[model samples]
Target: MASTLVSIAGYHVTEEIYNSSRTLVYRGYRETDHKPVVIKLLKNPYPSFSELLSFRNQYTIAKNLNLPLIIQTYSLEPYQNGYALVMEDFGGI
Candidate 1:
């Protein structure tokens, strides 16, 4: 796995909470409000175009969700050599 990312799109990555073949989830805080957030970073040199598309599709769906069971995505931003999906922090449940 790669070293923990320091920050992405202005959110400070405090700790890596999860990792898998496709993604890395981090505990972060929004720069402006200092609110906790979740950052999902795509692995560098994305394994495949389909994987990248899948991430974007998930973001689009999450962004429009209003259910309490679903975490809403705030935005997508380029990070490092890939992308990061900014989401509401659930404090790792």
Candidate 2:
């Protein structure tokens, strides 16, 4: 995602929390409810099929775990040319 991005759909991006060669993590809140969320996005504008699969797999696995220690998986939102993995923000930096 571009550094200038301020929001995504119903999310108001507050600040970018993490960045790596493969992903961009942002701290944001839902505009509708004001609940905190972490938005994980693919770094590549057009990710490969494998990368997409990994994102889906991770979300599926985490969502099914049903463990208290695991952060909640809110959604897999479509964005630009890829997707965003939205999760419960545990206030970690």
What TM-score, over all chains together, does every model reach? 0.84, 0.92
Candidate 2 structure, TM-score to reference: 0.92
Best by TM-score: 2
Off by over 4 Å in 2: 1-3
Tens-digit lDDT string for candidate 2 (22-77) = 99999989889999999999999999999999999988998888789989999999
| Model 1, residue 48: C-alpha shift (Å) | 2.5
lDDT of 1 by residue, 1-93 (tens): 887565565777888888887778888799999989988877656446777788889889888899989987889987766678899987764
What RMSD, rounded to one decimal, does every model reach? 2.5, 2.3
Model 1 error, position 27 (Å): 0.4
User: lDDT per prediction?
Assistant: 0.80, 0.90
Q: Which stretch of 10 consecutive residues in model 1 shows the poorest summed lDDT?
A: 42-51
Clashes of 1: 0
- Highest-lDDT candidate: 2
Clashing pairs in 1: none
> Clash totals for all models, in order?
0, 0
